[model samples]
Target: MSPSAVVNKRAVVVEPETTGHKNVKTKSVLLHRHIHYEPSTVVAAKGNYVELNSGQKILDATGGAAVSCLGHGNQRVKEAINRQLDQVAYCASLFFGSSAGEALAKELVDGTNGQMARAYIVCSGSEAMEATMKLARQYFLECAPAQPERVNFIARKESYHGTTLGGLSMSGHVGRRALFEPMLLGNVSRVSACNAYRGMKEGESTKEYVARLAQELDDEFVRLGPQTVCAFVAEPVVGAALGCVPAVPGYFQAMKAVCDKYGALLVFDEVMSGMGRSGTLHAWEQEGVVPDIETIGKGLGGGYAAVAGLLIGHRVIHVLDKGTGAFSHGHTYQGHPVACAAALEVQRIVREEGLVENARRMGEVLEKQLKERLSSHPNVGDIRGRGLFWGIELVRDKATKEPFDPKDGIAMALHEKGLEPKHSISLYPGTGTVDGKSGDHIMLAPAYNTTEADITLIVDRTTAAIEDFFAQRSYH
Candidate 1:
């Protein structure tokens, strides 16, 4: 590869990729996050290890935003995609449906054990969220009595839905929404998140906290006019936006009660925390509340294919079934046959191999290791999550719970250092920009099939990375 090369007879500037995203290093014709950053080049990958062209092997801990559940180069899924290609690869979703798509959708619906009535497969998490947002509006119109005024959406602060305009409007993530504030839909209002570390009053008990949070949601609905509210969108276990914060005991039940009282739909955005990443097949199952409309991605296809889906509850399906008899939204690539086949194969393995149980069991080991090692660190403020999903909040002063100054760039530094040659382990990190909070957070979302030994290696390398980051900062 030269600094300037042309395949299509055009000039191109080639530069190394940024180490900011897992030691990426390469020159390519793609628009990366930062124009001057270069990351390592991945030559190959097997199981949980990714190989770089420079011969460095990296332990994949975060699974690339918690995707890649089946790990790298899964032969079964590869064969499934190849088989689908031999038959039919692409088909217009609006005009026809393939057995591949139908089979995958049936599997998803059956996985819910009939709780979810229909499945609409899409290409990515953002698109799934964008679809669900539109579907909610359409659903109301198709209801027995059309409620056109039901446009207001209530979402919690410190939550992320997606990056598209509609998804951005529903999300409370600070940085991503700043650039499009003027253009984002203003119908979504935010309330306090169910984060116990930040939201709990000094003397409040768990029961009291639940009640207070529920009251806050009810109040928001009332303020917005109950009949005007469309839905309350949230991640059962908040994802990158809040760094894997799981709502406390009785949290979802309480929230659902509020939604029921107001006749607003309850939507769970399980893109990051669903599909066995959090031990259970669906994170909402653990919360004891089923969403009216659920959006899932990332782990859904396990990075074997581009796939995400919307799971509609029985009520929503019935309403639409009785009315217009069709959903008025879709993408060009909706229900792509090859993608569905790949996802279906990936899911089959996840179920047959018992990876969900492994995630639950290994999650205990992973969490215990993190707490035992870092809970006493001066900068460590909190450790909270469920199953394989965990997050560590880094504060400058644990006593005061004060976050490090934003200019310190602590989160990205910790992330980059963890992926260095010595560490050779990939991790996830969050700043105030992504999480809508004033602190640094590091997320550990390893593959669902990870072992005790893998967990141990991750913890050891990560602890060293944290210590090194702080020590180097002290020297400065």
Candidate 2:
């Protein structure tokens, strides 16, 4: 048998043969993202830990790409899901809508303080982003002037939007875009991301860095012919592509200024950073720049259901309302009732429990503990984040900020080491932190309601995992 077959065979666990005939367990036919090896079978999860079929309980620190904001198996969300299922599980959003979808959209719009006038629910971040792109294009067409020339988009480099083709076209993540480059649209262009650790020049003030980035964006708009640009897209806090890199202070404001100058919409893709992941309902709230169009997911459903939504600012809404009174794009599961209900309950729990504030408080403790435990380590080049989100960049030379060669797979190695029974932790790892081909970092995005003790455990296990990983290998 092949290596994958061997892994599949090992994954099977035969129950005790109580009957007269012998019983055998069947191998998993599920095609997981990772093809080379079978992933650990998670049998159960609760709070901050997930138990594998092997009975090894792993502490979930990253919340499965920062999706489980309220943690696993939330009773309230489960109940809400069942309630919606009993009432209306699914509906053709194009023809009919459910109370669950209406309530969720109203809550989302109100959460934005009316800045976002409408919410278009969808299945995932990719779908949300795809809708955002199409809406942007349609908005231009629907405008009084009918600027069909607006066909280009300006996005930041080293950012992740989503996985679909349109989302990929807007994303600047190199690895995710490499194989799909030929198939991606040509109208999308990229500017330097506001990554201070690596992008900020030595001796450069924060104001200067922000101004330079803003100018780069302005230049891109001018190069693309301002009239040809529909929007400038970015993540208020950069996610997986750069492993949770937050923008420098005044960064989003400056970017927004450039977009406004050219009459282009500002689109914030907050799939990973929104929905209280960064201690705020929307990441842009802290930046003081509300996006003209926004996409939110991941924590929006808190992993209870597959859901995301597009928040349309008044500017875009007015154009579409006045011109066509209809959005041209639609998905079959656009307003999934079960998903909306689950997300609504998750938001309710987050608000009632004051979990966002808790995330803010616990984030401080997590940062302090992480720095205290790992800052002095030679391989740890930088630790940065906001709220419950953070990343630790691994470097070969701390003094020079030299990233380990991509061939080393340092991030993946550390992630694997973290899963070892002794460490018993789950870490989110990312590569191409330096550019699109090099650099390594591990991310931590604990649940919004993570406590001080949980933070301590997380930091302890994380520190041990890092130390053990480095100890097993030598670099000169």
Model 2 accuracy (lDDT, Cα): 0.84
Candidate 2 Cα errors over 4 Å, as ranges: 1-27
Which residue pairs of candidate 2 clash?
Answer: none
Which 10 consecutive residues of model 1 have the lowest summed lDDT? Answer: 1-10
TM-score for each predicted model, relative to the true structure: 0.94, 0.94
lDDT of 1 by residue, 93-123 (tens): 8888999999999989998988899999999
TM-score of 2: 0.94
Cα lDDT tens digits, model 2, 199-287, are: 99899999999999999999999888999999999988787778778999999999989988989999998988888988788999899
Q: What is the lDDT of residue 193 in candidate 1?
A: 90
